[model samples]
Target: MSKVLYIKANIKKEGESRTFKVADSFIEEYKKNNPEDEIVVLDLYKENIDFLRPEDLGGIFGPKDETSKHHPILKYAYQFADADKYIIAAPMWNLSIPAILKAYIDYISVTGITFKYTEKGPVGLLKNKKAVHIVSRGGEYNNTPYEMGDRYLRTILGFFGIQEVETIAIENVDVMGVDLEEKMEDGIKRAQLIAQKF
Candidate 1:
């Protein structure tokens, strides 16, 4: 069975977060469609995900000794690399993903684990993996320059050799006069459709 990694990067719970609402629908559909698949959930808010420190940098750049091999950060990278599929749920904060999510990305972006540098350039190691981003925005940002969250995710995931990436956005959430329920319903429908094939 394929392994699916579900990364939850929001402080708000599923009942209160618009992003989680749509992501929940997608995950539910995905589970129904692929009951044999394994799902691993990582809640950033509940986890002790911290920013990179001096020791972390040393461990990453230093020699591959026993301490480095057993470093706590490497577990995140190993788990990320082992997954066949990824689902990231977050809200747009200042036109980008949450800082904690970025920190998690930092943990997983390990050299020789996710990517490797060659004579030509840095090449991703994990190939044939798929990913999807479920994001909620206060305003419309898709297809616009202001949209950086999904764009950043697509770029970074591509860096890790995951080329097949899709995004389901719940937009205009805070816009005045917008039908929030309708937008949510539309996002749910799209999410469910993607989940069927994801």
Candidate 2:
């Protein structure tokens, strides 16, 4: 069965977040299309992920220090290594990704774990995976100067060996206000259709 790992960065559950509805819609359709696949959802808002420490950096460099073996960093590295595909859902914050998503990336982006440097240069260890990013923005920002979140996300994921990344952005969310009802409907339909294709 295909394994899909979903990482959610939205802090709010439902009413507080306008972007969460879009993520829910995409996940519903994705699950419907690929019923046989295993979907693992990680709500970053709820999870207690360890922050990067100096020891974590030491562990990545093949630390001969025996204490590093029992570090929580190894568990994170293993979780990332096990995923076959990735789905990240978040709201654009300050023209960049949410802090939770950034924290998750920092946790898994270990030197020897996700990638390594050979004489030839840096090489990604994680392989054969694709990523789908669901981004919700308050303003219309795609292909604009403000669209740094998607570019940064894609670049970081690519560095981990997940080259094929598709982003579905729901823009003008906050700007639309109560008129957002129609926009949400349209965004859900578009995201669902894309998930079906994915």
Candidate 3:
């Protein structure tokens, strides 16, 4: 049974966050598909970590010992580095992810732990892991540069040696004349398919 880390980055309630609901649908199907797998959920809103604070340096310097580590940088980094798979669910705010989600990323992107620089260049430590991003966007920007959330997540995960990354995007959700329910259903349906194959 593999360990799957589910990161919920939205502040909205369970049913209010489109991305969260889609991810939950995906997890529901994932659990059905892989009954033995372990799923861990980390809600960013309730998680208090000063990710933007410059004084917190455990992530960059790497934890010296678990006994001495008192901050969330090592805690979040270890959780991420130890996971076999990841599920990041969030919505695009101002053409990017919410600040809390970005902060969570900062907490997890630990140097010499998640990734390291060698003579050849930076190398990802956990090459065997996989990741999936379930995001909801108000506008359509799937293949465009405006999709900063997807692009940044892909890049950072790739930097950590997770080469297998998938995205389930619910685009044109608000601005376009598309029905929210229909778009959400389609996203959930797609998530089910990915869950089976993942």
Candidate 4:
């Protein structure tokens, strides 16, 4: 069975966050379609992920000794590399991803683990993996230039050798005159269809 990593980076709780609502539907449908698949949930807020510090640099750039291999930061990289699929849930903040989500990305973007330096430049090591991004935006930004959260995420995932990436965005949630429930239900329906084929 494939291992699916569900990475939740929203600051708000599930009940209050529109992002979580869409993500929850996707995951529920995913579980139903792929019952044998293993799903690992990593909530950034509850994980209390910390930003990279000066002391953490040594373990990241230094030799992969026993101690360095067991470093907390490297643990995230290992977990990420082992996953066959990924589901990223995050909300747009300031037209970009949350800081905590970026911090988690830093932890997983380890050299010689997720990617390696080569003569042609850096090459991703993890191949044949796929990812889906689930996001909620207050306003419409999917095709606009102001979009950054999902754009950046897709770039980073590509850097990790994940070429097949899908996105499910629930946008215009807070826009005036928008039917919030209707929009959310539409997102949920799309999520379910994607899950069935995922």
Question: Which one is best on TM-score?
Answer: 4
Off by over 4 Å in 2: 63-70, 176-178
Residue 177 deviation, candidate 2, in Å? Answer: 6.3
> What lDDT tens digits, residue by residue, belong to model 4 across residues 78-111?
8899899999999899999999999999999989
Model 2 C-alpha lDDT per residue in residues 1-198, reported as the tens digit of each score = 788888888878556665667777878998999999888888887787646778667666664344644566665566776788888888899999988788888878777678888999888887778888888888889989878989998998888888889887888878835478788888888889988977
Runs off by more than 4 Å, candidate 1: 63-70
Which segments of candidate 4 are over 4 A away from where they belong? 65-69
Top-lDDT structure, candidate number: 1
Model 4 deviation from the true structure expressed as Cα RMSD, one decimal place: 1.1
Candidate 3, pairs of clashing residues: none
RMSD of each: 1.4, 2.6, 1.7, 1.1
Q: In angstroms, how far off is 116's CA in candidate 3?
A: 1.3
Superior by lDDT: candidate 1 or candidate 3: 1
What's model 3's overall lDDT? 0.86
Task: Give Cα-based local distance difference scores for all models.
Answer: 0.92, 0.80, 0.86, 0.91
Residue pairs in clash, model 4 = none
lDDT of 3 by residue, 15-118 (tens): 88889889999999999999999999989888864556666764457445665245556778778888999999988988888899888888777776688878
Global Cα lDDT for candidate 1: 0.92
